[model samples]
Target: MDDLPDDALGDVLRRLPPRWLAASRCVCKAWRRTIDERRLLRPDLLPLSFAGIFIQFDSHAFPEFFARPSPSSANTKLDFLP
Candidate 1:
């Protein structure tokens, strides 16, 4: 794996499942560095963006909102005014 070019390595690493990726990070310093340096976080593999977290104050009501992944440029949390 180390023999591959950085871009090639990133392509391979980005396809790994999250658990395997986490384990791969533990393998060695070189692997860890490669993973961190490339930052191969594909859009489909990422978690939904942290737009905001809402909790309801009412005892009888449950609040719900769907989270969708935001583009890298727009990761801001704004208070939802009722």
Candidate 2:
């Protein structure tokens, strides 16, 4: 497979689904470079976003909240308590 040109290798890899594409990345450095250089796999397709977290303690009445701070979250409030 190393003998294959990048264009040809990329063509073959492009048809694979996200799962296989990720596996191909681990095959070798050349294949990984080709995949990254041609953008065969999109970073946005992977789940890398951090939204928020909730933690509850045995002694607490409510769960503690920790969220990723963003402009849209500026007005966000924890009004779930009653």
Candidate 3:
């Protein structure tokens, strides 16, 4: 259900918390613009952005934190070694 079609991505962005949408912008340029416009129009999105930031910080601070690098960059770090 989370994987929305390209045509409906805007609506999905509207439903999601601003923070997730903001983070999602990194997914692509178009998505970032959509989320940025949505956030600009709706002040309520601020809280969601704040929550998003907190969640992001917590995840980054966790010992088990992990993320997939962009396909273009595969630099091996010690933490990712098997």
Stretches of candidate 1 off by over 4 Å are: 41-82
> Can you write out model 3's per-residue Cα lDDT over 1-82, one digit (the tens) per residue?
3466545877877776656765777887777776676553365554442211222456547544345444677666788568
State every prediction's TM-score relative to the real structure: 0.43, 0.58, 0.36
Model 3 TM-score (2 dp): 0.36
Ranked candidates (TM-score, high to low): 2, 1, 3
Model 1 error, position 69 (Å)? 38
Off-target runs (Cα >4 Å) in candidate 2 are: 49-82
CA lDDT scores, all candidates in order: 0.73, 0.86, 0.61
Q: Compared to the true structure, candidate 2 yields what TM-score? A: 0.58
Clashing pairs in 3: none
